[model samples]
Target: MTSPNAAQVPTIKSALKFFKVTSYITGIFLILIMVLWAIRLIWSADVWIGGPDGLIALAQFSVDPSTGEKVGLPGPQIPNDFTTVSLIIHGWLYVAYLFGDFRLWTLLRWSFLRFLVIALGGVIPFLSFFTERYYSKVAEADLKKVA
Candidate 1:
């Protein structure tokens, strides 16, 4: 005895639930990555200037590239370079988070302004954790009413 629109309700509800879960998980991961980035940035003052790997320099004992004499230039600081991999992974995950936001927002027919506000949760460090809790409560309440 369900109308066509009623049939669609479950699908939409499920999608929203998924987004809420995903948003929480991805948000947590992004927060952790941001923490790692901060640690690396604060600690890498001297060598962390070049890039994620710091600056690449020839060893002090190595020959110069242009000249034939033994010389050295800054090279990637040992494991600091490894942080580049984390940076790339976080970037891609954030993109995926955006898609999850789109799906949930589209299904719920949320206003663009609200969507933008929610999207900010991903970038502003620990904001995601707060936003995720707030949205989970909202979604749960709304679902309860529907049921």
Candidate 2:
């Protein structure tokens, strides 16, 4: 049996809690992308660090079309050249983040423009961490003021 006015008070704890959870999830996704990129760069030297030498070597070797003989011709480079496991994980996680972002924005009555920036946090490297920290601080401060 609480009074109507009691409900009017903003609950900072709840807001902070939501922010923290979403931040953690998003950060994990970003880290995964980075890890994938590193693995691809290190293990698949023929594509990245090997540069022109690796490229040339990779291109000239193929199987003979008619005789099943191993033919040496420059073949197309791996399509995953620009991608890694990180990109795939990050992409899916980003869509999930959108749902969380919308939920939080609705809860906090945050502006659409601010929400857009938050959503864009995934594309840029290390940006999500900074954005999460900044938003967490802002939400915490707001909660304190309400208290």
Using Cα atoms with residue i matched to residue i, what is each candidate's TM-score against the true structure?
A: 0.62, 0.55
For each candidate in the order shown, give its overall lDDT on alpha carbons: 0.60, 0.57
Native RMSD of candidate 2 (Å): 9.2
Candidate 1: regions farther than 4 A off: 1-5, 45-80
Question: What tens digits encode model 1's per-residue C-alpha lDDT throughout 65-116?
Answer: 7886433334444443334555666677677777767765675566787678
Candidate 2, number of clashes? 8
lDDT of model 2 at residue 116? Answer: 86
Off by over 4 Å in 2: 1-12, 41-88
Instruction: Kindly report which residue pairs in candidate 1 clash with one another.
Output: 56-74, 56-75, 57-73, 57-74, 57-75, 58-73
| Steric clash pairs (candidate 2) | 33-86, 59-73, 59-74, 59-75, 60-72, 60-73, 60-74, 64-69
Top-scoring candidate (TM-score)? 1
